[model samples]
Target: MLKKSDMIAMALGVVLGAAATVPAFAAGGGGDPPPPPTCAKGQVYSAKKNACVKAERGALPDEEMTQYAYALAKQDRFQEALNMLDLLENPNTPKALNYRGFATRKLGHTEEGISYYLKSVALDPNYAQVREYLGEAYVIQGKLDLANSQLATIKTICGTGCEEYEDLARAIEDSKL
Candidate 1:
């Protein structure tokens, strides 16, 4: 027979195991439903309706649009990402700027990307992801020192164990070769 403590431990383990399988984006907004699968161009996933919907200003919250733009960037749809970002009512947010920088950088305009990253950092200096991306842009420009500086800043915002730190560190290291 299982003791009460053992039963509780088993339940906790099950919950944690399920959580571990969840995609990272699921945590973007507190308890945001799992994002729907990728929608075609000019469409976006709507958590409210649990389906894809035509992308339009005011159709979804800015946060959701930003999340969708970020997803587009991750999928290598840089132009689509920028178009989605344009739909945001206010595109000056740190996350919006960061996504713009990411898409711009991936599109081979490193200088423009750096400018966006700087604006984002100015808005939210503690955003480690922006620091990482800024460092990467520096690496692309052969400015290892600047990249390293951003890496150090990222370390201060989030410890070396953070994904941003690890990714930037790897980018800096890879630049050396």
Candidate 2:
């Protein structure tokens, strides 16, 4: 059985490794992946801090909404995540584009997904998360050379010890096995 923490890491899209083949149903009907974070009694979720801060009125800032969309995507709720992305004020922001790419790729729109990921990376060359995901996409497409390039880019951005570097490198290695 996959540990609950391992599943959480997968949900966060960090590094599921080859163990993800264990099957979701293998979880033995584990409950949903935590409610949409209610943020204590008075705080609100912050993507910057990834925790909660004093609640601000009006619509949620784009960063928080993007994080929420990612959570939705992690649960395999791709369409709902895309819907949330569409409603964002700056839908074209790099982070938003990355989530859109993630949802699109998971939905099997490979070429389109790569386009979105490319757009996001173009916007910010140092975006290691986007690079890791983009590398995964390349691996799925059987583009080993391209995937290696992304791993190198991640290494440059985050060094060899960063989670992004390690996860993407594992993905590239796993693709060969």
Candidate 3:
């Protein structure tokens, strides 16, 4: 009685339901709520170990390093963030590329940052945060149309009320003023 399409839909539903059970951190929604960014330049706060750890390559998980790098970029420590990002074993991940773009852009390399953001977006089109950063970069380059395109994508991914959408929206607004 069931068509092949119906069976495939049911299987997909089951897989998605299982994926929904994963913890937000494990699923890359922010990663264990990183500790305060008080670690030294060569160290990163490890949530699992509950303390700072040397940021040597392979010393910590790639995801943790990527998250810390993003945090460092937020603090305007662009070079330090890039150092940490370089330590990632798999640097091509969406989060890693997004952070790299963020740090690069902050360091005044807009084109390089846009390249990284494009790679991140290619890997994960639904990643709203990357879209937001990409939109901001477009704004910086005075490309309002490209920024608006990213804004529309973010609106579809997380709606206009989400932080990514709000941040990009604010950046676009501020650009026009």
Candidate 4:
């Protein structure tokens, strides 16, 4: 079995990878026009490599673009995720902001990620996933109390058995070990 920490990370990775099909985000909509058909399409921002590479492009809808960005983030290509996210018209939309936060934190910009997550939560207090992520980000920063507070918020939002509540609770439990 994977170590608990690895499980948490893996669970998150799986969630990110599968997020493209996650319907909860679909309920929210973005109307941003896609970037021009050249280098901007499907290119991710890679801060660690300090580079961006052109990828396939087409007439993908705004939702697909966001999903593409989330997929890039799942592969650890966070900067690319950033690049993809920029093409979104509704960047401030809670779902978009949530993915932006995911890519930001994955790339080591913890505070920036937290800012995005906070913005997402502010936009929609019912965003359990964002709260869970914000809590995990707090844990990474060694702020257990703050994470616990987020966990409490998530509990209020989704009760104790939902994915967000369980994930944050597991992260907190793992942190204590």
Maximum-TM-score candidate: 1
Of 1 and 2, the candidate ahead on lDDT is 1
Off by over 4 Å in 4: 1-58
Sorted by TM-score (best first), the order is: 1, 3, 2, 4
Q: Write the per-residue lDDT of candidate 2 for residues 24-100, one digit (tens) a residue.
A: 53442223233355454334456557676654332478777777777778778787678767767788888899999
Query: What is the Å distance of residue 56 in model 3 from its true position?
Result: 0.5
Comparison by lDDT, 1 against 3, better one = 1
Q: Give the winner by lDDT.
A: 1
- Per-residue lDDT, model 4, residue 116, is 97
TM-score of each: 0.85, 0.68, 0.79, 0.67
Error of 1 at 62 (Å): 0.5
Better of 2 and 4 by TM-score: 2
Please, what are the lDDT tens digits per residue for candidate 4 over residues 1-177?
789999999999999888965564443422333322223445643333445544434335466667668767767778888877887766788878999999999989999999999999999999888999899999999999999999999889879977789889999899999
- RMSD of candidate 4 to true structure, Å: 13.7
Q: State the displacement of the C-alpha of residue 10, model 4, in Å, after optimal TM-score superposition.
A: 39
lDDT of 3 by residue, 67-176 (tens): 78888887888999999999989999998999999999999999999999999999999999999999999999999999999999999998977778999999999999
Q: Candidate 3, which segments miss by more than 4 Å at Cα?
A: 1-36
Question: Which residue pairs show collisions in model 4?
Answer: 32-89, 44-79, 44-80, 45-79, 45-80
RMSD of 2: 12.5
